[model samples]
Target: MQTGGHIAGWRHARAADNALCDAEYFQALGRTAEKGLFDGVFLADYVGYHPVKGAAVFAGLETPKLDPLVVLATIAAATRNIGLIGTASTTYSHPYDVARRFASLDHVSGGRAGWNIVTSTMENEAHNYGFEAHLAHADRYARADEFVAVARKLWDSWQAGAVVADKVSGAYTDPARISAVDHQGEHFRVAGPLTVPRTPQGHPVLVQAGASATGQQFAAANAEVIFTSHPTIFTAQAFRADMHTQLAQFSRSPESLKIMPAVTPVIGRTRSEAEDLKRELDDLIPARIAISKLEGLLGNVDLSGADPDGPLPALPAEALAGENSTRDRVLELSEREMLPIAELARRVAAGRTGHTIVGTAEDIAETLIEWENCGAADGFVISAPFLPGGLEDFVDMVVPILQERGHFRREYEGTTLRENLGLAVPPNGFDADPTSRRRPEIW
Candidate 1:
């Protein structure tokens, strides 16, 4: 159970405005997270522009960006302790290449690298990858299961002692210890050892963010860390319990996976100031943009004809089937609260379906602690509504309170990401012990 910061939302209006592509912004963000002794800083990814051609895509925070792994590499050079996690999609990436990239990052970062595995959900992403459309939800997960399996095999191809580098013996590597993966899965076929050696953490800690039933099963079998978004504590608790139950089916312990839900905090020295900041950001979002974004979240439902101040339109019966968990939450809230389209859009934009808190440092810290203590989450993937400023506030204001309460660490506990996250170094698959030779049950 630990804290991690996601800086994607930081590029929003009124906070670090127009600095999304700046390396310095990210470096400062990394340092701030490290200063707070946060476990990691995650960089989210999207390969294509919004499928809906609208202002939300043109005027939104998700503008063109640098590659996440490249961004993380820059962050790694600036920070000493914090883990750097980069999101890469399994559906669009080749396992061999993804394995090499993350493994290289782990080496360069002194083992503080994590790979956030995602099955590309946006249809635009599929188009970018030369596909007609995004794979169906279940099909995507099926591909992801094999994708991860191939990557794991490649990572394990080289044993721990594969690299001898003995100068006197005129030997660089132990050939006997290095072998080809020879993997031929339904979605991917990867051969031989990865270009890089076994990483510092055995392999970059596998992180997943899927929330579907198939997603939970894949995470239970493979993910060491699972990033999630839930609007309420009760839902988060239920999801965590479900993941643990899924873990048991894989013969894994509940402790094997860390469930970190997304939390966006708008904090100020005073509650009123926090409220003012939220209001400022909300006002900046045009109703058109908000409505467009909301439409995307609701399974691309056409909301243009609906009255902004009127109640939400009735959802299609099969809406939940193709939609994600966030959409489910949004629909549930709309139905329960009977919210107007305008109000619902604002709330969705504010937190993007995750829990959003507006308060002083003390209030924010108390809420976070309550969630952790109540089994709602193992920790949180903190989304600062705005960049350096929002992140800086949390690190400076809320972090101290959490530290003082002994709920969070004042200093990093370990060197590698796995060590810091309290995850065990996965046993090498080439090890002689039978227990150590089993592949990660990613399927």
Candidate 2:
């Protein structure tokens, strides 16, 4: 997330002001993440921000969005060990294009590439793709289901060792090591092999971002890593358990999928100091921006004239009827706490849906460890509340504590991201190895 994941993060005095256009800024952040021995640096870009009814208030979120693939490639060139995970909406893209991009990225990054797959949810995304409207959630996932299937076929077309340069025999390639996918599915009809060779990690790691029931099913069948959000340890634990059960249904082991929850850490030298920092950041939020953010989240209900200090007004039927779990949770929070419009907006702006850890470095470390020990997360996807500084703090301060406690690595575990993450390279699809660890059900 460029400036930071927090919507108002860019306004913070300490946040990087030029990150939107500054390649060097991102490169620096990648290096910092690498220094912490993070499994990957996740870049969240919107093909279109998910918008709902009255979403025009957000102008359909036609904001300048980065192409994560382009940015990840830059980071790939700069950083050697950290994984490069880029967001691409299967809803708005073709399976062949996405498959080839990540495969090339994996090869370029020395097997440190990952694809964060999303079935985009936005009207603008639909328009950009030359459609009149967004596909329904079920339809989107259905398409994504077929999209990934075809992509794997393309990736698998070129078997491992497909290239054999026998100079004397004048054989530069092995015809036996390659095959055409010739796939025909409900959403896609892809023929033959990907232009790129099989990547160093077999195929770049597949990461899925969606927590809905249907989304979870897709992740179980297709994704090797999942990016999820839950506000509490219990919620996260419940989610992890549910996913484990789902994985079994696909003939996958508990270790096959890594569940990574988004976490934002607000650290300070002392507990009181941390609380103060959180307050300071919250205070920095401009009321209009906060309310606009809330409006966007809740189907863009018009809060223009609503009193920021007043309680949340009765939401329209459409807002309440939508299946957005995040919106529902926000509503529940307001009713449960009787929080005023502005307060809730600010709260939402600061953390969105992810859990926030506010404390000293030790406190942050302990919270993370507790969550891991309690089966709440396979790992965490830390969203630095602000860039460079927030990330640097975690790397410099919190990382040492984790390393000392033996919860985190002192150095990366291996050269390739697959090795460091402890994932096996999926066997080439052309020739299936029943015993060989493969991407979940890729065959």
Candidate 3:
């Protein structure tokens, strides 16, 4: 998360100075995560200027973000083992380029790269890519489905024994082991082998974050690591249950995918200390900026004249028509909880970026265990309110408790992220023996 997930995280006293575009800052973050044996560090991306202006212009929101792959590559040199996941949109990028980049990343990181696949629906992103408007949601996912298919074919183009450095014979490669994809699909057409060879992981882990019906369908068929969000435990359970059913229909084993919901943990030694920190961060968000974010989320409907403390006005029909997963969740929260404008805006501001928990390490740890054991989640994508300090707290405080309880790992299980996550390495589509790529059991 840039600085942190919260809108006001940069202003927090604990946040590092000059983190924007700082390579060392991220390298340090990577090392810290590895110290705690985290699965990976996820780096988010926003390609173009967003329509929202108030927050960026006033609240010091980190914008013009570095390319996630470039940043993650930098982190790769500084740490080992943790998966380096970066966002790459199927909408704006071609399958060949996307596959090549991640293949190279997987090679360099020793098989610890993940692709957080997104079908971007942002009009602003469309504008930058020479499109008058973003594609429809269905069209986007359809493209993504094909995009991934092509990428996989490209990855599998080179078989395991494709490379053999023969000195005397002077044959550096095995032609029999390499094949051209020659793919012609509805969304993409790519011919031949990827420029990069087969990666260390065979294929980079396919990650996704889509909660809509079409989103779920795509995720169920493809995503190896699914990033999701739910404000309540019950909703999380419902979503996971639905996903499991969908997975069964696909004939995929339950262990094939991991569903991770983003959770922001505001931690402290005592309850009061944690509550104070949460309020302190929330209080940093300016009223105008908070309302502006809500406006953007609600399809940029003009809320300038609306009362900041009153209930949200009925969303316009136009806004309703373009509703996305994030927008729908915010609306659902408001309708279900009857939260006022100010309160709702505040939650959106202060890292209700996902479900937020404020408490001592024990309380937060217990909550995590409860969600896991109750079938509410397979895992969590922990989003700290502010960087360095917030993550360090979780690693030092919460992680230990989970480990002590025998629910979390005391040490990483294996070298590769797939191994650590207990996921099998994906087989090459071209392989005659699919199980050849399976990761050996570590435990």
Candidate 2 residue-wise lDDT, 19-68, digit = tens: 56668987988899998999989987766665433555454222356788
- RMSD of model 2 against the true structure: 4.0
Q: Rate the local accuracy (lDDT) of all candidates.
A: 0.82, 0.82, 0.85
- Candidates sorted by TM-score, best first: 3, 1, 2
> Model 3 has how many clashing residue pairs?
0
Best by TM-score: 3
TM-score against native, each model:
0.93, 0.92, 0.95
Scanning candidate 3 in windows of ten residues, the lowest lDDT window is: 434-443
Worst lDDT 10-window in candidate 1: 1-10
lDDT by residue (tens digit), candidate 1, 170-205 = 999876667677777777766666779888898899
Which of candidates 1 and 3 reaches a greater TM-score?
A: 3
Model 3: per-residue Cα lDDT over 1-443, one tens digit each? 66778888878888887666888988988998888889999977767754666545443543447899999999999998899999999999999999999999999999999999998756889999999988988889889999999999889988888889899899987876777787878878787688788888898888998778889999999999899988989999999889999999899987899999999999988999999999899888887778777777666778777787788999879788843887898889888889899888888877654789999999999999999998988889999888888988988899989999988988889888788878898877778654433221221
lDDT of 2 at 137: 78
Tell me how many residue pairs clash in candidate 1: 2
Tell me model 2's lDDT, rounded to 2 decimals. 0.82
- Residue 415, candidate 1: alpha-carbon lDDT: 92
Q: After superposition, how far is residue 168 of candidate 2 from its true place, in Å?
A: 4.3
